[model samples]
Target chain A: MTMNKLQKSERFSVVKKILIIITSLFAGFATGVFGGGGGMIIVPILTGLYGLQQTKAHATAIATIFPLCLVSVIFYLTHGGWEWKSGLVVTAGVVVGGIVGALAMKKIPAKWLQPIFYILMIVGGIKMLAQ
Target chain B: MQYLWYIIAGLIGGVIGGMGMGGGTLLIPILTIFLGVEQVEAQLTNLISFLPMAIVAVIIHAKNKRIDFKAMLWVSVPALVTACVGAYFAPRVKSEWLSKGFGAFLTLLGVAMIIKIIVQKIKSKRRANK
Candidate 1:
């Protein structure tokens, strides 16, 4: 009898282990620097390393960012960096934009998305270099 | 072995981000190309990672009295709200289009930055000559 492919418990186990390692390192250090790139890394890692579906990877990435942002926000607040009014506005916009972006992501083709994302990276990089 | 790479990446990312240069620029490319991660995943990772860095920067700026609560409030509230909206809608949208749109945004931002820098340099030179 062919081993039940769905019952391949080893796959899930491996995925879990990889996820834990990636999440911890990506979230932890990236948080410390107050930067992004972890999101970029997470999705790819989830799909490549953990073999998750692209959609699932994307969802997971979004979920992970929430807590990370929350913690950073808290840290800023404690440091008296919480600009209530501005934070509120940006947060508002981000929340709205984020939702829209997320919704849009589901329908987009990965192939099309990749080039655009890459272009964005190059442009963003050039901008930084200029600065 | 990987820990070393992680530390290095983090350090570089931190310095660039702390300087307000946008770590996503570096992180995204590296993740996609070097790390062999998918583009969407890399972008998501960058977005998620940015939260903490942004928050920290905000805090540092606040401590330095450079936060400009008034300005920050204006910028952040809208940003936050939109971010949520974006996130909520992300699942439904086409990733390819989103990627293209995001790329256009980045390119525009880059061009703007370049122009700004050039203008600043020119103005500084004029002032020095005067």
Candidate 2:
């Protein structure tokens, strides 16, 4: 039974694999272009297409974005448009806050956070557009 | 004084980003709109700052066994190759357009997320009633 199940799972068609790759490439392009869309793109594809669990999708998206972000950084740096000093300062805060936030996720359920995040995004977006 | 703002922006963006949503969505706006940084500069800064935050978050999530390593392989390579493609075009785009585009993108993302949650809630409710 286990072997049969494994075989069944392994039988993803070439079309399916190609679709996944295409979706992933689009997600990466969005991430590179927006500098922030990786999770927004990857999580949905993982959950909707691959049927991964929500938490697992979120975690996996982060793992995937890590290398993609690194690659994007190389191009951004070579292009000479960034301020290293400001970037470093922000990074210091981001690193510390990231660890704290990750730990905090264990304490709070994601459902509770989603509404607030959406509201924040809307407000931030409106503020940007208004300016 | 300005450094303080940068740190604060980073910290907030980091926390949110570490939560599994991209920080650049929030960080870039905070830097560009609020802190008065240029669009390209803010974007670059966001990308740069994002690296460390993502790395740190991944570490924490991995420790908790939240990550599905197998699924990661499918996205990583394709994403890695295309990310540079996007970055290459970023600077060439006009700043005004970039700002407007980012704003529109964020608004759409917010709307989509809200709709998704509402749909999920209704579906779960129907399931429970059934």
Top DockQ hit: 2
Give all candidates' CA lDDT scores.
Answer: 0.45, 0.81
Per-prediction TM-score: 0.46, 0.87
Worst 10 residues of 1 chain B by lDDT: B70-79
Q: Give Cα distance to truth, residue B37, candidate 2, Å.
A: 1.0
DockQ, prediction 1: 0.05
Q: Which stretches of candidate 2 lie over 4 Å from their true place?
A: A1-18, B60-66
Instruction: Evaluate every candidate with DockQ and list the scores.
Output: 0.05, 0.69
- Candidate 1 wrong stretches, greater than 4 Å: A1-131, B1-8, B54-56
TM for candidate 1 is 0.46
In terms of lDDT, which candidate is strongest?
Answer: 2
TM-score of chain B of 2: 0.85
Please give, for residues A48-125, the per-residue lDDT of candidate 2 as tens digits: 877799888887887888887787777777777567788899989888878777788789766687789888889988
RMSD of 2: 3.5
lDDT, residue A38, candidate 1? 39
